[model samples]
Target: MSKAEKTKQFIIEKTASLFNTKGYLSTTLSDIAQATHLTKGSIYGNFANKDELAIEVYKYNSGLLSKSMSRSFGDEFPTTMDKLHAFVDFYRKNWRSVFSNGGCPLMNAATESDDIFPGLKNQVKKSFEDWAGKISSVIIQGQKNGDLNEKANAEEYASIFIMLLEGGILLSKTTGDEKFLNLALERITKMIDNELNILPS
Candidate 1:
Protein backbone atom coordinates (compact mmCIF):
# COMPACT_ATOMS: atom_id res chain seq x y z
CA MET A 1 0.00 0.00 0.00
CA SER A 2 1.04 3.54 -0.63
CA LYS A 3 2.01 5.82 2.22
CA ALA A 4 -1.27 7.73 1.93
CA GLU A 5 -3.37 4.59 1.99
CA LYS A 6 -1.42 3.27 4.96
CA THR A 7 -1.89 6.56 6.79
CA LYS A 8 -5.59 6.48 6.08
CA GLN A 9 -5.82 2.92 7.42
CA PHE A 10 -3.72 3.85 10.41
CA ILE A 11 -6.07 6.68 11.23
CA ILE A 12 -9.07 4.43 10.86
CA GLU A 13 -7.46 1.72 13.01
CA LYS A 14 -6.43 4.17 15.71
CA THR A 15 -9.82 5.85 16.02
CA ALA A 16 -12.19 2.95 15.51
CA SER A 17 -12.35 2.14 19.20
CA LEU A 18 -12.58 5.81 20.11
CA PHE A 19 -15.63 6.35 17.90
CA ASN A 20 -17.21 3.14 19.16
CA THR A 21 -16.66 3.97 22.84
CA LYS A 22 -17.09 7.72 22.84
CA GLY A 23 -19.73 7.84 20.10
CA TYR A 24 -19.89 9.51 16.70
CA LEU A 25 -21.62 12.71 17.72
CA SER A 26 -19.66 13.17 20.92
CA THR A 27 -16.30 12.38 19.36
CA THR A 28 -14.66 15.51 18.02
CA LEU A 29 -12.10 16.03 15.32
CA SER A 30 -9.59 16.92 17.99
CA ASP A 31 -10.22 13.61 19.69
CA ILE A 32 -9.43 11.76 16.47
CA ALA A 33 -6.38 13.89 15.92
CA GLN A 34 -5.14 13.09 19.39
CA ALA A 35 -5.85 9.41 18.93
CA THR A 36 -3.94 9.26 15.67
CA HIS A 37 -1.27 11.85 16.52
CA LEU A 38 -2.24 13.58 13.30
CA THR A 39 -3.30 17.15 12.88
CA LYS A 40 -6.85 18.00 11.92
CA GLY A 41 -5.59 18.93 8.47
CA SER A 42 -3.93 15.56 8.07
CA ILE A 43 -7.11 13.83 9.07
CA TYR A 44 -9.13 15.95 6.67
CA GLY A 45 -6.68 15.23 3.90
CA ASN A 46 -7.13 11.52 4.44
CA PHE A 47 -10.91 11.74 4.87
CA ALA A 48 -13.08 14.26 3.11
CA ASN A 49 -14.52 15.27 6.46
CA LYS A 50 -15.43 14.02 9.90
CA ASP A 51 -18.68 12.50 8.68
CA GLU A 52 -16.85 10.53 6.00
CA LEU A 53 -14.28 9.39 8.48
CA ALA A 54 -17.00 8.28 10.90
CA ILE A 55 -18.54 6.09 8.22
CA GLU A 56 -15.19 4.54 7.36
CA VAL A 57 -14.40 3.95 11.02
CA TYR A 58 -17.69 2.19 11.55
CA LYS A 59 -16.96 -0.07 8.58
CA TYR A 60 -13.48 -0.80 9.89
CA ASN A 61 -14.74 -1.73 13.38
CA SER A 62 -17.53 -3.88 12.01
CA GLY A 63 -15.12 -5.59 9.58
CA LEU A 64 -12.80 -6.55 12.40
CA LEU A 65 -15.72 -7.98 14.34
CA SER A 66 -16.83 -9.99 11.31
CA LYS A 67 -13.35 -11.40 10.86
CA SER A 68 -13.17 -12.47 14.49
CA MET A 69 -16.49 -14.29 14.27
CA SER A 70 -15.51 -15.97 11.00
CA ARG A 71 -12.29 -17.17 12.64
CA SER A 72 -14.18 -18.62 15.60
CA PHE A 73 -16.38 -20.69 13.33
CA GLY A 74 -13.53 -21.60 10.95
CA ASP A 75 -13.91 -24.57 8.59
CA GLU A 76 -14.07 -27.33 11.13
CA PHE A 77 -17.80 -27.13 11.69
CA PRO A 78 -19.44 -28.89 8.77
CA THR A 79 -22.96 -28.91 10.13
CA THR A 80 -25.39 -26.00 10.36
CA MET A 81 -26.23 -26.67 14.00
CA ASP A 82 -22.56 -26.61 14.83
CA LYS A 83 -22.23 -23.20 13.19
CA LEU A 84 -25.23 -21.85 15.07
CA HIS A 85 -23.87 -23.13 18.34
CA ALA A 86 -20.55 -21.57 17.50
CA PHE A 87 -22.33 -18.28 16.86
CA VAL A 88 -23.74 -18.27 20.37
CA ASP A 89 -20.48 -19.50 21.79
CA PHE A 90 -18.66 -16.72 20.06
CA TYR A 91 -20.62 -14.14 22.03
CA ARG A 92 -20.39 -16.11 25.27
CA LYS A 93 -16.62 -16.41 25.11
CA ASN A 94 -15.82 -13.05 23.60
CA TRP A 95 -18.21 -10.69 25.37
CA ARG A 96 -15.27 -9.03 27.06
CA SER A 97 -13.51 -8.31 23.82
CA VAL A 98 -16.75 -7.04 22.36
CA PHE A 99 -17.50 -4.82 25.34
CA SER A 100 -13.97 -3.51 25.59
CA ASN A 101 -14.12 -2.46 21.97
CA GLY A 102 -17.25 -0.47 22.88
CA GLY A 103 -19.85 -3.18 22.55
CA CYS A 104 -21.16 -4.49 19.24
CA PRO A 105 -20.68 -1.91 16.50
CA LEU A 106 -24.12 -2.62 15.10
CA MET A 107 -25.82 -1.85 18.39
CA ASN A 108 -23.72 1.21 18.96
CA ALA A 109 -24.21 2.61 15.48
CA ALA A 110 -27.88 1.70 15.33
CA THR A 111 -28.69 3.59 18.51
CA GLU A 112 -26.58 6.59 17.67
CA SER A 113 -27.45 6.92 14.03
CA ASP A 114 -31.15 6.36 14.47
CA ASP A 115 -31.56 10.02 15.46
CA ILE A 116 -28.33 11.74 16.29
CA PHE A 117 -26.45 11.00 13.10
CA PRO A 118 -28.72 10.25 10.23
CA GLY A 119 -25.80 10.11 7.85
CA LEU A 120 -24.68 6.77 9.15
CA LYS A 121 -28.11 5.17 9.28
CA ASN A 122 -27.86 3.62 5.81
CA GLN A 123 -24.52 1.93 6.47
CA VAL A 124 -25.69 0.65 9.83
CA LYS A 125 -28.87 -0.66 8.25
CA LYS A 126 -26.92 -2.50 5.57
CA SER A 127 -24.64 -4.02 8.18
CA PHE A 128 -27.61 -5.49 10.08
CA GLU A 129 -29.20 -6.80 6.90
CA ASP A 130 -25.93 -8.50 6.01
CA TRP A 131 -25.65 -10.01 9.47
CA ALA A 132 -29.17 -11.42 9.39
CA GLY A 133 -28.54 -12.72 5.89
CA LYS A 134 -25.61 -14.77 7.16
CA ILE A 135 -27.68 -16.34 9.93
CA SER A 136 -30.60 -17.10 7.67
CA SER A 137 -28.30 -18.66 5.10
CA VAL A 138 -27.06 -21.09 7.72
CA ILE A 139 -30.59 -22.08 8.63
CA ILE A 140 -31.43 -22.62 4.97
CA GLN A 141 -28.38 -24.81 4.59
CA GLY A 142 -29.42 -26.87 7.61
CA GLN A 143 -32.83 -27.44 6.11
CA LYS A 144 -31.27 -28.64 2.86
CA ASN A 145 -29.00 -31.01 4.78
CA GLY A 146 -31.93 -32.38 6.82
CA ASP A 147 -30.25 -31.35 10.03
CA LEU A 148 -32.89 -28.74 10.81
CA ASN A 149 -36.65 -28.74 10.49
CA GLU A 150 -37.67 -28.22 6.90
CA LYS A 151 -40.67 -26.22 7.98
CA ALA A 152 -38.65 -23.85 10.05
CA ASN A 153 -38.63 -20.23 8.93
CA ALA A 154 -35.02 -19.32 8.35
CA GLU A 155 -35.67 -15.58 8.37
CA GLU A 156 -37.75 -15.77 11.51
CA TYR A 157 -35.16 -17.82 13.31
CA ALA A 158 -32.45 -15.46 12.22
CA SER A 159 -34.41 -12.46 13.47
CA ILE A 160 -35.07 -14.13 16.81
CA PHE A 161 -31.42 -14.97 17.25
CA ILE A 162 -30.36 -11.42 16.48
CA MET A 163 -32.99 -9.89 18.75
CA LEU A 164 -32.07 -12.13 21.64
CA LEU A 165 -28.36 -11.61 21.22
CA GLU A 166 -28.52 -7.86 20.72
CA GLY A 167 -30.96 -7.47 23.58
CA GLY A 168 -28.69 -9.52 25.76
CA ILE A 169 -25.76 -7.34 24.86
CA LEU A 170 -27.64 -4.14 25.69
CA LEU A 171 -28.95 -5.40 29.01
CA SER A 172 -25.68 -6.92 30.14
CA LYS A 173 -23.71 -3.87 29.20
CA THR A 174 -26.17 -1.65 31.02
CA THR A 175 -26.28 -3.74 34.19
CA GLY A 176 -22.55 -4.43 34.27
CA ASP A 177 -23.40 -8.10 34.65
CA GLU A 178 -23.11 -11.00 32.24
CA LYS A 179 -26.18 -12.89 33.45
CA PHE A 180 -28.50 -11.12 31.08
CA LEU A 181 -26.52 -12.25 28.06
CA ASN A 182 -26.01 -15.69 29.56
CA LEU A 183 -29.74 -16.08 29.96
CA ALA A 184 -30.34 -15.02 26.39
CA LEU A 185 -27.76 -17.43 25.04
CA GLU A 186 -29.21 -20.25 27.17
CA ARG A 187 -32.63 -19.59 25.67
CA ILE A 188 -31.16 -19.61 22.19
CA THR A 189 -29.47 -22.98 22.70
CA LYS A 190 -32.68 -24.43 24.06
CA MET A 191 -34.58 -23.09 21.06
CA ILE A 192 -32.14 -24.79 18.74
CA ASP A 193 -32.43 -28.08 20.55
CA ASN A 194 -36.18 -28.08 20.92
CA GLU A 195 -37.52 -26.04 18.05
CA LEU A 196 -35.06 -26.32 15.22
CA ASN A 197 -33.12 -29.53 15.55
CA ILE A 198 -34.40 -32.46 13.46
CA LEU A 199 -34.07 -35.77 15.19
CA PRO A 200 -33.59 -38.91 13.13
CA SER A 201 -36.38 -41.48 13.15
Candidate 2:
Protein backbone atom coordinates (compact mmCIF):
# COMPACT_ATOMS: atom_id res chain seq x y z
CA MET A 1 0.00 0.00 0.00
CA SER A 2 1.15 3.53 -0.74
CA LYS A 3 1.59 6.15 1.96
CA ALA A 4 -1.73 7.74 1.05
CA GLU A 5 -3.57 4.41 1.11
CA LYS A 6 -2.08 3.56 4.49
CA THR A 7 -3.06 6.94 5.85
CA LYS A 8 -6.58 6.57 4.57
CA GLN A 9 -6.87 3.12 6.11
CA PHE A 10 -5.44 4.37 9.38
CA ILE A 11 -8.05 7.08 9.50
CA ILE A 12 -10.76 4.58 8.72
CA GLU A 13 -9.64 2.20 11.45
CA LYS A 14 -9.35 4.92 14.06
CA THR A 15 -12.75 6.49 13.42
CA ALA A 16 -14.75 3.35 12.57
CA SER A 17 -15.97 2.96 16.11
CA LEU A 18 -16.70 6.66 16.37
CA PHE A 19 -18.91 6.57 13.30
CA ASN A 20 -20.65 3.43 14.48
CA THR A 21 -21.27 4.73 17.99
CA LYS A 22 -21.92 8.41 17.30
CA GLY A 23 -23.27 8.21 13.73
CA TYR A 24 -22.46 9.57 10.26
CA LEU A 25 -24.38 12.86 10.41
CA SER A 26 -23.31 13.54 13.95
CA THR A 27 -19.60 12.94 13.30
CA THR A 28 -17.51 15.80 12.02
CA LEU A 29 -14.11 16.36 10.48
CA SER A 30 -12.84 17.77 13.76
CA ASP A 31 -13.94 14.61 15.54
CA ILE A 32 -12.09 12.54 12.96
CA ALA A 33 -9.03 14.75 13.30
CA GLN A 34 -9.11 14.16 17.04
CA ALA A 35 -9.52 10.41 16.60
CA THR A 36 -6.68 10.06 14.09
CA HIS A 37 -4.52 12.88 15.38
CA LEU A 38 -4.30 14.24 11.85
CA THR A 39 -5.08 17.68 10.55
CA LYS A 40 -8.20 18.31 8.51
CA GLY A 41 -5.94 18.99 5.58
CA SER A 42 -4.34 15.56 5.87
CA ILE A 43 -7.77 13.94 6.16
CA TYR A 44 -9.06 15.79 3.16
CA GLY A 45 -5.95 14.81 1.26
CA ASN A 46 -6.69 11.15 1.92
CA PHE A 47 -10.47 11.39 1.44
CA ALA A 48 -12.44 13.81 -0.69
CA ASN A 49 -14.66 14.83 2.24
CA LYS A 50 -16.28 13.69 5.46
CA ASP A 51 -18.97 11.84 3.52
CA GLU A 52 -16.40 9.81 1.58
CA LEU A 53 -14.54 9.02 4.77
CA ALA A 54 -17.74 7.91 6.50
CA ILE A 55 -18.57 5.55 3.65
CA GLU A 56 -15.10 4.03 3.82
CA VAL A 57 -15.32 3.68 7.58
CA TYR A 58 -18.66 1.93 7.23
CA LYS A 59 -17.14 -0.46 4.69
CA TYR A 60 -14.18 -1.14 6.94
CA ASN A 61 -16.36 -1.88 9.96
CA SER A 62 -18.88 -3.94 8.01
CA GLY A 63 -16.09 -5.87 6.24
CA LEU A 64 -14.73 -6.96 9.59
CA LEU A 65 -18.17 -8.30 10.47
CA SER A 66 -18.52 -10.10 7.13
CA LYS A 67 -15.12 -11.70 7.51
CA SER A 68 -15.88 -12.71 11.08
CA MET A 69 -19.09 -14.44 10.08
CA SER A 70 -17.31 -16.14 7.17
CA ARG A 71 -14.59 -17.39 9.49
CA SER A 72 -17.17 -18.78 11.90
CA PHE A 73 -18.66 -21.00 9.19
CA GLY A 74 -15.83 -21.26 6.70
CA ASP A 75 -14.40 -24.78 6.61
CA GLU A 76 -15.39 -26.24 9.95
CA PHE A 77 -18.91 -27.07 8.93
CA PRO A 78 -19.21 -29.70 6.23
CA THR A 79 -22.98 -30.02 6.03
CA THR A 80 -25.66 -27.42 5.47
CA MET A 81 -27.25 -28.05 8.87
CA ASP A 82 -23.89 -27.71 10.55
CA LYS A 83 -23.21 -24.48 8.70
CA LEU A 84 -26.56 -23.02 9.67
CA HIS A 85 -26.05 -24.07 13.27
CA ALA A 86 -22.62 -22.47 13.23
CA PHE A 87 -24.17 -19.28 11.97
CA VAL A 88 -26.43 -19.03 15.00
CA ASP A 89 -23.64 -20.18 17.31
CA PHE A 90 -21.33 -17.45 16.11
CA TYR A 91 -23.74 -14.73 17.27
CA ARG A 92 -24.56 -16.59 20.47
CA LYS A 93 -20.92 -16.48 21.57
CA ASN A 94 -19.78 -13.26 19.93
CA TRP A 95 -22.73 -10.94 20.50
CA ARG A 96 -21.06 -9.39 23.51
CA SER A 97 -17.82 -8.78 21.67
CA VAL A 98 -19.77 -7.33 18.77
CA PHE A 99 -21.80 -5.12 21.12
CA SER A 100 -18.72 -3.95 22.95
CA ASN A 101 -17.34 -2.65 19.67
CA GLY A 102 -20.52 -0.54 19.19
CA GLY A 103 -23.01 -3.19 18.16
CA CYS A 104 -23.55 -4.42 14.59
CA PRO A 105 -22.11 -2.02 12.06
CA LEU A 106 -24.67 -3.00 9.44
CA MET A 107 -27.52 -2.30 11.82
CA ASN A 108 -25.97 0.93 13.02
CA ALA A 109 -25.33 2.17 9.50
CA ALA A 110 -28.74 1.08 8.21
CA THR A 111 -30.62 3.00 10.84
CA GLU A 112 -28.38 6.03 10.53
CA SER A 113 -28.21 6.14 6.75
CA ASP A 114 -31.78 5.46 5.71
CA ASP A 115 -33.64 8.60 4.49
CA ILE A 116 -30.82 10.69 5.95
CA PHE A 117 -27.56 9.88 4.24
CA PRO A 118 -28.24 9.18 0.57
CA GLY A 119 -24.62 8.41 -0.14
CA LEU A 120 -24.50 5.69 2.47
CA LYS A 121 -27.94 4.16 1.94
CA ASN A 122 -26.89 2.44 -1.28
CA GLN A 123 -23.75 1.08 0.29
CA VAL A 124 -25.71 -0.27 3.23
CA LYS A 125 -28.21 -1.80 0.86
CA LYS A 126 -25.44 -3.59 -1.01
CA SER A 127 -23.98 -4.88 2.23
CA PHE A 128 -27.34 -6.30 3.25
CA GLU A 129 -27.94 -7.85 -0.17
CA ASP A 130 -24.50 -9.46 -0.05
CA TRP A 131 -25.18 -10.84 3.40
CA ALA A 132 -28.47 -12.35 2.33
CA GLY A 133 -26.77 -13.75 -0.77
CA LYS A 134 -24.21 -15.61 1.32
CA ILE A 135 -26.87 -17.27 3.48
CA SER A 136 -29.07 -17.99 0.50
CA SER A 137 -26.15 -19.59 -1.30
CA VAL A 138 -25.70 -21.99 1.59
CA ILE A 139 -29.36 -22.99 1.53
CA ILE A 140 -29.43 -23.24 -2.25
CA GLN A 141 -26.39 -25.48 -2.26
CA GLY A 142 -27.94 -27.63 0.42
CA GLN A 143 -31.07 -28.17 -1.58
CA LYS A 144 -29.09 -29.15 -4.65
CA ASN A 145 -27.11 -31.66 -2.63
CA GLY A 146 -30.22 -33.15 -1.08
CA ASP A 147 -29.02 -32.10 2.36
CA LEU A 148 -31.95 -29.78 2.90
CA ASN A 149 -35.61 -29.80 2.01
CA GLU A 150 -36.12 -28.84 -1.61
CA LYS A 151 -39.33 -27.02 -0.82
CA ALA A 152 -37.57 -24.46 1.30
CA ASN A 153 -37.11 -21.10 -0.38
CA ALA A 154 -33.48 -20.12 0.02
CA GLU A 155 -34.02 -16.42 -0.59
CA GLU A 156 -36.93 -16.23 1.82
CA TYR A 157 -35.05 -18.15 4.47
CA ALA A 158 -32.08 -15.87 4.06
CA SER A 159 -34.24 -12.79 4.45
CA ILE A 160 -35.95 -14.20 7.52
CA PHE A 161 -32.67 -15.09 9.17
CA ILE A 162 -31.28 -11.61 8.62
CA MET A 163 -34.44 -9.96 9.92
CA LEU A 164 -34.46 -12.12 13.03
CA LEU A 165 -30.80 -11.58 13.74
CA GLU A 166 -30.88 -7.85 13.17
CA GLY A 167 -34.09 -7.44 15.10
CA GLY A 168 -32.59 -9.47 17.90
CA ILE A 169 -29.51 -7.29 17.94
CA LEU A 170 -31.62 -4.14 18.10
CA LEU A 171 -33.73 -5.46 20.93
CA SER A 172 -30.76 -6.82 22.83
CA LYS A 173 -28.82 -3.61 22.44
CA THR A 174 -31.78 -1.47 23.46
CA THR A 175 -32.63 -3.49 26.56
CA GLY A 176 -29.04 -4.31 27.55
CA ASP A 177 -29.89 -8.00 27.59
CA GLU A 178 -28.96 -11.06 25.52
CA LYS A 179 -32.23 -12.91 25.73
CA PHE A 180 -33.67 -11.26 22.68
CA LEU A 181 -30.80 -12.33 20.46
CA ASN A 182 -30.77 -15.73 22.10
CA LEU A 183 -34.44 -16.17 21.42
CA ALA A 184 -33.88 -15.30 17.81
CA LEU A 185 -31.08 -17.79 17.50
CA GLU A 186 -33.27 -20.42 19.14
CA ARG A 187 -35.91 -19.88 16.51
CA ILE A 188 -33.32 -20.06 13.71
CA THR A 189 -31.98 -23.35 15.03
CA LYS A 190 -35.47 -24.78 15.37
CA MET A 191 -36.35 -23.64 11.89
CA ILE A 192 -33.30 -25.33 10.49
CA ASP A 193 -33.92 -28.58 12.30
CA ASN A 194 -37.64 -28.79 11.77
CA GLU A 195 -38.35 -26.96 8.59
CA LEU A 196 -35.22 -26.94 6.44
CA ASN A 197 -33.37 -30.12 7.22
CA ILE A 198 -34.26 -33.23 5.26
CA LEU A 199 -35.18 -36.36 7.15
CA PRO A 200 -33.92 -39.83 6.34
CA SER A 201 -36.50 -41.44 4.10
Candidate 3:
Protein backbone atom coordinates (compact mmCIF):
# COMPACT_ATOMS: atom_id res chain seq x y z
CA MET A 1 0.00 0.00 0.00
CA SER A 2 0.96 3.60 -0.47
CA LYS A 3 2.10 5.77 2.40
CA ALA A 4 -1.14 7.69 2.45
CA GLU A 5 -3.22 4.52 2.61
CA LYS A 6 -1.05 3.05 5.35
CA THR A 7 -1.23 6.26 7.35
CA LYS A 8 -5.01 6.41 7.09
CA GLN A 9 -5.31 2.78 8.21
CA PHE A 10 -2.97 3.47 11.09
CA ILE A 11 -5.17 6.30 12.26
CA ILE A 12 -8.28 4.15 11.99
CA GLU A 13 -6.73 1.24 13.86
CA LYS A 14 -5.34 3.49 16.55
CA THR A 15 -8.57 5.37 17.14
CA ALA A 16 -11.05 2.52 16.75
CA SER A 17 -10.87 1.41 20.36
CA LEU A 18 -10.89 4.99 21.57
CA PHE A 19 -14.07 5.75 19.68
CA ASN A 20 -15.66 2.54 20.89
CA THR A 21 -14.81 3.21 24.50
CA LYS A 22 -15.19 6.97 24.76
CA GLY A 23 -17.94 7.29 22.12
CA TYR A 24 -18.31 9.41 18.99
CA LEU A 25 -19.28 12.82 20.33
CA SER A 26 -17.28 12.45 23.52
CA THR A 27 -14.10 11.60 21.59
CA THR A 28 -12.35 14.55 20.03
CA LEU A 29 -9.65 14.93 17.43
CA SER A 30 -7.21 15.63 20.23
CA ASP A 31 -7.95 12.27 21.79
CA ILE A 32 -7.34 10.57 18.46
CA ALA A 33 -4.12 12.47 17.98
CA GLN A 34 -2.96 11.42 21.42
CA ALA A 35 -3.91 7.79 20.85
CA THR A 36 -2.34 7.64 17.39
CA HIS A 37 0.60 9.87 18.16
CA LEU A 38 -0.28 11.84 15.04
CA THR A 39 -0.46 15.57 14.70
CA LYS A 40 -3.84 17.28 14.26
CA GLY A 41 -2.79 18.29 10.76
CA SER A 42 -1.91 14.70 9.96
CA ILE A 43 -5.27 13.48 11.24
CA TYR A 44 -7.15 16.10 9.26
CA GLY A 45 -5.06 15.28 6.23
CA ASN A 46 -6.25 11.67 6.44
CA PHE A 47 -9.84 12.49 7.42
CA ALA A 48 -12.10 15.31 6.30
CA ASN A 49 -13.50 15.98 9.77
CA LYS A 50 -14.38 14.42 13.06
CA ASP A 51 -17.61 13.00 11.66
CA GLU A 52 -15.80 11.38 8.77
CA LEU A 53 -13.12 9.98 11.03
CA ALA A 54 -15.74 8.62 13.44
CA ILE A 55 -17.60 6.92 10.59
CA GLU A 56 -14.47 5.10 9.52
CA VAL A 57 -13.52 4.17 13.06
CA TYR A 58 -16.97 2.77 13.67
CA LYS A 59 -16.63 0.63 10.57
CA TYR A 60 -13.24 -0.61 11.72
CA ASN A 61 -14.53 -1.59 15.15
CA SER A 62 -17.63 -3.26 13.73
CA GLY A 63 -15.51 -5.22 11.27
CA LEU A 64 -13.38 -6.57 14.07
CA LEU A 65 -16.47 -8.05 15.75
CA SER A 66 -17.85 -9.42 12.47
CA LYS A 67 -14.56 -11.09 11.63
CA SER A 68 -14.30 -12.69 15.05
CA MET A 69 -17.81 -14.09 14.87
CA SER A 70 -17.27 -15.32 11.32
CA ARG A 71 -14.07 -17.09 12.34
CA SER A 72 -15.68 -18.76 15.33
CA PHE A 73 -18.74 -19.82 13.34
CA GLY A 74 -16.77 -21.11 10.38
CA ASP A 75 -13.64 -22.62 11.85
CA GLU A 76 -14.43 -24.12 15.22
CA PHE A 77 -17.89 -25.51 14.75
CA PRO A 78 -19.08 -28.34 12.52
CA THR A 79 -22.82 -28.77 13.11
CA THR A 80 -25.49 -26.09 13.14
CA MET A 81 -26.07 -26.54 16.85
CA ASP A 82 -22.36 -26.38 17.39
CA LYS A 83 -22.20 -23.18 15.36
CA LEU A 84 -24.96 -21.59 17.41
CA HIS A 85 -23.22 -22.60 20.60
CA ALA A 86 -20.03 -21.09 19.27
CA PHE A 87 -21.68 -17.65 19.33
CA VAL A 88 -22.18 -17.89 23.07
CA ASP A 89 -18.75 -19.40 23.53
CA PHE A 90 -17.05 -16.66 21.52
CA TYR A 91 -18.41 -13.89 23.78
CA ARG A 92 -17.83 -15.96 26.92
CA LYS A 93 -14.19 -16.61 26.05
CA ASN A 94 -13.34 -13.24 24.57
CA TRP A 95 -15.30 -10.88 26.84
CA ARG A 96 -12.10 -9.68 28.48
CA SER A 97 -9.57 -9.99 25.69
CA VAL A 98 -11.75 -8.85 22.81
CA PHE A 99 -15.10 -7.41 23.88
CA SER A 100 -14.08 -5.33 26.92
CA ASN A 101 -11.76 -3.29 24.71
CA GLY A 102 -14.79 -1.60 23.28
CA GLY A 103 -17.75 -3.69 24.46
CA CYS A 104 -19.50 -4.79 21.27
CA PRO A 105 -18.79 -2.04 18.80
CA LEU A 106 -22.15 -2.31 17.09
CA MET A 107 -24.03 -1.94 20.38
CA ASN A 108 -21.83 0.92 21.48
CA ALA A 109 -22.30 2.76 18.19
CA ALA A 110 -26.03 2.14 18.13
CA THR A 111 -26.59 3.42 21.64
CA GLU A 112 -24.24 6.37 21.38
CA SER A 113 -24.96 7.54 17.86
CA ASP A 114 -28.69 6.96 17.63
CA ASP A 115 -29.83 10.54 18.05
CA ILE A 116 -26.72 12.42 17.04
CA PHE A 117 -25.10 10.67 14.10
CA PRO A 118 -27.59 9.65 11.46
CA GLY A 119 -25.02 7.99 9.25
CA LEU A 120 -23.63 5.91 12.08
CA LYS A 121 -27.09 5.02 13.34
CA ASN A 122 -27.98 3.72 9.89
CA GLN A 123 -24.81 1.70 9.70
CA VAL A 124 -25.58 0.19 13.08
CA LYS A 125 -29.04 -0.74 11.85
CA LYS A 126 -27.58 -2.41 8.79
CA SER A 127 -25.21 -4.34 11.01
CA PHE A 128 -28.11 -5.72 13.01
CA GLU A 129 -30.02 -6.64 9.86
CA ASP A 130 -27.00 -8.41 8.44
CA TRP A 131 -26.41 -10.34 11.66
CA ALA A 132 -30.03 -11.35 11.86
CA GLY A 133 -29.95 -12.51 8.26
CA LYS A 134 -26.95 -14.70 9.00
CA ILE A 135 -28.58 -16.32 11.98
CA SER A 136 -31.80 -16.92 10.05
CA SER A 137 -29.90 -18.51 7.18
CA VAL A 138 -28.22 -20.90 9.57
CA ILE A 139 -31.54 -21.84 11.08
CA ILE A 140 -33.00 -22.48 7.65
CA GLN A 141 -30.07 -24.71 6.79
CA GLY A 142 -30.40 -26.62 10.02
CA GLN A 143 -34.07 -27.22 9.35
CA LYS A 144 -33.32 -28.52 5.88
CA ASN A 145 -30.80 -30.94 7.30
CA GLY A 146 -33.25 -32.14 9.92
CA ASP A 147 -30.92 -30.97 12.65
CA LEU A 148 -33.29 -28.30 13.92
CA ASN A 149 -37.05 -28.11 14.36
CA GLU A 150 -38.74 -27.26 11.10
CA LYS A 151 -41.43 -25.34 12.91
CA ALA A 152 -39.09 -22.76 14.34
CA ASN A 153 -39.31 -19.34 12.75
CA ALA A 154 -35.82 -18.42 11.68
CA GLU A 155 -36.30 -14.66 11.67
CA GLU A 156 -38.15 -14.61 14.97
CA TYR A 157 -35.58 -16.80 16.63
CA ALA A 158 -32.76 -14.71 15.18
CA SER A 159 -34.32 -11.52 16.54
CA ILE A 160 -34.74 -12.96 20.00
CA PHE A 161 -31.24 -14.34 20.03
CA ILE A 162 -29.72 -11.00 19.09
CA MET A 163 -31.80 -9.13 21.66
CA LEU A 164 -30.97 -11.54 24.44
CA LEU A 165 -27.27 -11.59 23.71
CA GLU A 166 -26.92 -7.83 23.32
CA GLY A 167 -29.07 -7.19 26.39
CA GLY A 168 -26.89 -9.58 28.36
CA ILE A 169 -23.78 -7.75 27.29
CA LEU A 170 -25.27 -4.43 28.30
CA LEU A 171 -26.35 -5.72 31.67
CA SER A 172 -23.01 -7.40 32.26
CA LYS A 173 -21.10 -4.24 31.49
CA THR A 174 -23.40 -2.01 33.48
CA THR A 175 -23.40 -4.20 36.60
CA GLY A 176 -19.77 -5.36 36.36
CA ASP A 177 -21.02 -8.92 36.62
CA GLU A 178 -20.34 -11.62 34.07
CA LYS A 179 -23.15 -13.72 35.47
CA PHE A 180 -25.77 -11.74 33.61
CA LEU A 181 -24.12 -12.57 30.31
CA ASN A 182 -23.61 -16.17 31.33
CA LEU A 183 -27.23 -16.46 32.31
CA ALA A 184 -28.33 -15.25 28.93
CA LEU A 185 -26.04 -17.68 27.20
CA GLU A 186 -27.32 -20.50 29.34
CA ARG A 187 -30.89 -19.63 28.37
CA ILE A 188 -29.91 -19.57 24.72
CA THR A 189 -28.31 -22.98 25.09
CA LYS A 190 -31.46 -24.39 26.55
CA MET A 191 -33.52 -22.85 23.77
CA ILE A 192 -31.26 -24.38 21.19
CA ASP A 193 -31.28 -27.82 22.74
CA ASN A 194 -34.89 -28.05 23.83
CA GLU A 195 -36.82 -25.79 21.47
CA LEU A 196 -34.84 -25.65 18.25
CA ASN A 197 -33.13 -29.00 18.03
CA ILE A 198 -35.08 -31.85 16.51
CA LEU A 199 -35.72 -34.71 18.86
CA PRO A 200 -36.33 -38.37 18.16
CA SER A 201 -39.95 -39.30 17.68
Identify the candidate with maximal lDDT. 2
Clashing pairs in 1: none
- Give the runs in model 2 whose Cα sits over 4 Å from its true position: none
Q: What does candidate 3's lDDT look like per residue over 1-201, in tens digits? A: 999999999999988888988988899888998999999999999889999989888888888788888775684578998998887788888887655686888888899887789989998999999889988888899999889999999999999988988999898888888898888889888998899998789
Rank order (by lDDT, best first): 2, 1, 3
* Poorest stretch of ten by lDDT in candidate 2: 67-76
lDDT of each: 0.90, 0.92, 0.87
**All candidates: TM-score:** 0.96, 0.97, 0.96
Model 1 alpha-carbon miss at residue 32, Å: 0.6
Arranged by TM-score, best first = 2, 1, 3
Candidate 3: give its CA RMSD in angstroms.
1.2
Model 1: how far residue 91 lies from native, Å: 0.5
As for model 2, its CA RMSD to the true structure in angstroms is: 1.0
Q: Which should have the higher TM-score, number 1 or number 2?
A: 2
